[model samples]
Target: MLAVIRYSVPESQSQDFIKQAHVILDTLAGEPGFQRGRLARSVDEPNLWALVSEWEGAGFYRRALSAARMAMYPLMILMVNEPSAFEDVYVSGQEE
Candidate 1:
C-alpha cells in the first residue's frame, strides 16, 4: 500500500479550493488503482489538513494526482510513503 500525505495552509478562497479538491478526489476514487482516501483536519490547527490516500502498489499516485490537480493545487508540501507499514482499518486490534 502507498500513502500520500499533503500539507498546506488554508487559502483565502477556501471554498473554491475545496470545490476543486472534490473534483480531484472524485476522479481518483473512480480510478482502477485507488484503494481509499481519508481527508483529515486538525481541530487545533484549522489551516492544516492531511489527505491520506491508499493505492495499489503498482500505481503512481503523484503523477496521477499532479495531472488531475495541477491548476487547483496551491504550493504545498507533499510526502509519499511506500514500503512503510500503515494501519489497516479492517484489522482487529488490542489497544494500549
Candidate 2:
C-alpha cells in the first residue's frame, strides 16, 4: 500500500523537527514490511512537510504507522492519508 503523510511543524521547532525526523524515518525503514520512504517540502508552505511511504501490504502499513504515531505525538501536528487505490509504475527516468 502507498501511504502519504502530511505534517506541519511550528517555525520555532523546525530545527528540532529536522533533527528528530530521521529517527522516525529510520524506524520505519527497519520494519519488515516497509518498502520505501521519502521526505518532501512544500513549495509555497514553508512549514509544511510530507512523508510518502510504501509497504508490503495494507495491514503491515497500518501497524507500523500506528506505532510511529504514538512515538511522534509530542512533536507536532500530524496528518496521514492513504488512498485506497494506487499503482506502482517505474518511469525510465526514475530510479529505485
Candidate 3:
C-alpha cells in the first residue's frame, strides 16, 4: 500500500517544514512493515510537498499511524492538506 500526505507550506517556513518532515519520516522508518518513504517538493510549486511512504499493507500502515511512539501526528495535522492511502492497481509490463 502507498500512503501520501501532501503539505502546503509558506515560502518562509519551508525550511522548518522540511525539518519536521524529516523527523516524521525517520520515525516512520523504524516502524514495522515500513518498506520505504520519501519527501518530494513540487517543481512548479515550491511550497507544495508530499511525504510518500510504502507499507506492507493497509493494516500495518494504520497501526503505525496509531502507534504510541508516533509523535509526528501533531506536526502532520498542521501541515497536511489531504492525506490518502492507495492500493496498487497496475504496473508497467505486468499485463504482458
lDDT of each: 0.58, 0.71, 0.81
Prediction-by-prediction clash tally? 0, 0, 0
Prediction 1 global C-alpha lDDT: 0.58
The collision pairs in model 3 are: none
Clashing pairs in 2: none
- Which regions of candidate 3 deviate over 4 angstroms? 68-70, 77-83, 93-96
| Candidate 3 lowest-lDDT run of ten | 68-77
How accurate locally is residue 2 in candidate 1, as Cα lDDT from 0 to 100? 52
Ranking by TM-score: 3, 2, 1
Candidate 2 lDDT tens digits, 1-96: 677667776688877776667777777887778988877778899888876788887787777867787556655454444353244565367678
TM-score of 3: 0.84
Cα lDDT tens digits for candidate 1, 1-96: 555455555557556556655666676676667888766666887666556677765445655565666543553333233342244455347563
Cα lDDT of candidate 2 equals 0.71
TM-score of each: 0.59, 0.72, 0.84
TM-score of 1: 0.59
- Local distance difference test, candidate 3: 0.81
